[model samples]
Target: MLLSIDWIFIIEKCILIAVIIGISLVVAMYETWAERKVAAIMQDRRGPNRAGVFGILQPMADGLKLFMKEEIIPNLSNRFLFVLGPGLAMLTAMMTSAVVPWSSHLDIKGRMVSLQVADINIGILYIFGVVSMGVYGIMIGGWASNNKFSLLAAVRGASQIISYELAMGLSFIALLMLTGTLSLRTIVEQQQDHLYNFIYQPLGFFIFLICAFAECNRTPFDLSEAENELNFGYHQEYSSMKLGFYLFAEYVNMFISSAVMATLFFGGYDIPFVNDISFGQQHGQNVLAILQGLSLFVKVGVFIFFFMWVRWTIPRFRYDQLMRLGWKILIPLALINMLATGFIILLRNNGWHL
Candidate 1:
């Protein structure tokens, strides 16, 4: 009986992994479609609608084109590391979802079903650790390419990510103090009673949000991939699926980051006033679990749309200005925010709860 139970557990885990990966890929593909549509509207032009109804099939067509294209390797490049770079980029982007708490567990036929792939105690730390490592992919790829422009772009990209990560980490410190736990599940649970951290920590939220844009290389922070200056930037020397991986990994990273932001500051899967509804109470546990899952997707979708909207609306930041924003502005602001939060929390604990 123990062996049978172990087998069942393994099967369930495998199924969960498959579902998350499949959904992530689909979301990444459609993000590309949505981005193009958004750009077209901003530019006052009709976007890709020729391929299928509302241009829904354009991603598939683009995939086929990329697959059929010739794979190129420059003679001077380190072929192995060149290939490994994009693979690492894609892998790190996908790996971040492993710890995100999508929903509370479901009760199914006396068996508990976990909504997350892995509910490690240090889930938020795991996200930060993994995301910090993503810069290596771009750095390695650019350095291995043996091209001056690629190397320059890679250095810029590395510097930007590292600088912004400091502000991002500081922002999380305020949330950590409030929740008193690094586990994302516990953080989400804490928000169910009163308010989201975003309401209390608006300054930190704004800092983190802007830092996220820099980390993801989105405009007005896409200095690393500025086309006119760097000629397509770090992945400039790549072609075929290799180049595709770098680009695809970008959108995937954006989707994952948006999900993380939503989970962290926006209360994950908890809808406002949802506890007052009878549907959540009268229904069985399984039904409530499904509703929670739906809530998470809706939140994630809104965040994704906000990402595209900002990308289209903002202009790229100049390189020096980007550096100044990170080091001179955001860092100092984040430090002040952290100190204030700590002071408030201390006062509250002494019967002066604000």
Candidate 2:
């Protein structure tokens, strides 16, 4: 029965997975380099120009350094969970990309092949579930380290992520109501026929964007890793490549978050102001697919740069302030946005009748 099954499809999916993972790792690696360069430009200093021209090889050098570093596991730590922590973080970071629609379909030997790995019905929900699981990685790593500071940071991270997720889910409710579908590809298709969801749900988008920062443990919301307070935060006891995995997972999460934001609010692979179907007809399906892929990456790149820019420009938020903003402010706003969206949708369905 297995042999009779469509092995070609399985092979194609495996290849796609490999390609996507490769691309993600490459992007995450360079994000470290880009972060430094952005900081340099903003701070008016040379960032990294030693390893190669403009220090293009710096990320490789850094990776090599991490690989060569001594791996040290605390004697008091849980050996199994200690090793699993960063691996889980890296795994969850990459998992979220499975549902993201990278581009329009590619015509491969008269077959229409989707660029996305899985066009699941509940793509958004899958993202949320995976993102929520990401906290477990931090929590386990912190707890297993057998350090008070690590535990405290982990607790802080867990609380912060949980608090903001309420606002994030509520904000997404408004978008789901607007799109009327859980499938991400369908949502992108719907946007192609109309204005981007951002126009309709700017407040929701704002809330989601803020929540995304918190979710990814990025600046202003990066209370868990507050250097001054927690002494480098949850992974304090970690060293070598394990520590590298935790840090590298962060950039991967950032990349995925940027892609999600771009897909949900900005139209995933759609070229702005260009009629995609017409272009595909004018050119070819494969050519069009390539351009659309480039378009999506460009959007993702812009968001990634914005993430780096904000990190350099904004300081980390106080824990109290972060909690207050997430619970008191963003939650209420998200609820209001959801209610207002539903009300508007109901009215439009009834021709604006009372």
Candidate 3:
């Protein structure tokens, strides 16, 4: 006998994937606009307002310009890997969002609809796996450029990411200890009724946030692209849209990291007083689900703004200081936090009220 398949579910999954990829691209594009506007405001100047109303069309214009520009290949570079670098960077940046829970869920035509693209049981592991792979993009790109500065920057970038990932993973271990699950959805659900993880895991949250900045190569930790010293860093030899992709991927990674932070520590889509304001009794499930989704977006937006704000406000760190901070400070601090969390949990389990 032939088995029946759920084509509707397949179509829904495809639509969700398309929406996520589209959102990531659009967010990355407009982040350029947002960054320029923020920098202009900070520096006391007018930002891009020439292309369209309030420069809303600037990203589109920029994309068109990049597309129209001639692609340049450096004479001594490895042509294949040079071309592959930016593509890999952009791909890894986009892939990290696949397992994040965008919102709780919605009741659609009597079926429960999950807001995430993928609700894999190993959501946190999946995020870490994809995020860790992003370094290869930089390493490959920089090596392929066939330039001394690019190779140095690539080595620095790879080493820094690897160092920070250890601290980042340790911080997650504390959260996992508290939540007792690696699934992002389970962690979010746990945060719904009580305090957000940020309250209890403040140190872990801080370490994770800083590590995220390093992972995404943001200012204060953006040694990989230190223009004055390294001459545009890893993508120094790239031009046109290839160059655009490298820059664009950085912002996309920043945006995704912000979203991940919000989801992991800021209660995801659970609003304060949401439980008190009964959804089934008043607004109904669908409307309530929509509100939850909106709440999550607001949280993600605030985090993104913070990311841009820091980029404009803070100066990049010196290389030695960056290494010292990540290794000597953050890693040790994360370990201490984990120990404290373990002690508290052990005490609580034993009925010790202190």
lDDT of 1 at 183: 86
Candidate with more favorable, higher TM-score: 1 or 2: 2
Highest lDDT among the candidates is held by which one? 2
What is the lDDT of every predicted structure here?
A: 0.89, 0.93, 0.89
For model 3, how does the per-residue alpha-carbon lDDT over 1-354 read when each residue is reduced to its tens digit?
486889888888888889888888898889899989988999998899999998999999999999899888999999999999999999999998888887777788888878788888888989899989999899999999999989998999999999999899999999989998888888888898779999989999999999999999999899999998757888888889999999999989988998899889999888777682477458777787778877888888898888889999999998899999989999999999999999999999999986
- Taking the tens digit of each residue's C-alpha lDDT, what string does model 1 give over 1-354? 545467778888889889988999999999999999989998998899999999999999999899899999889999999999999999999999998887777887889989888888898889899989999999999999999999999999999999999999999998888888988888888887769889989999999999988888888888888988658899999999899999999898888888888889988877767882356569877787778877888888887888889988877887889999999999999999999999999999999946
TM-scores for all predictions: 0.96, 0.98, 0.96
Q: Indicate the TM-score of model 3.
A: 0.96
lDDT of 2 at 256: 94
lDDT value, candidate 1, whole model:
0.89
lDDT of 2 at 151: 95
- Give the per-residue lDDT of model 2 (tens digit) for 1-354: 546878788888899999999999999999999999999999999999999999999999999999999999999999999999999999999999999999989999998889999999999999999988998889999999999999999999989999988899999999999999999999999999899999999999999999999998999788888887658889999999999999999999999999999999999999999999999999999999999899999999999999999999998888788888998999999999999999999999989854
lDDT of 3: 0.89
**Cα-lDDT of candidate 2:** 0.93
Total clashes for model 3:
0
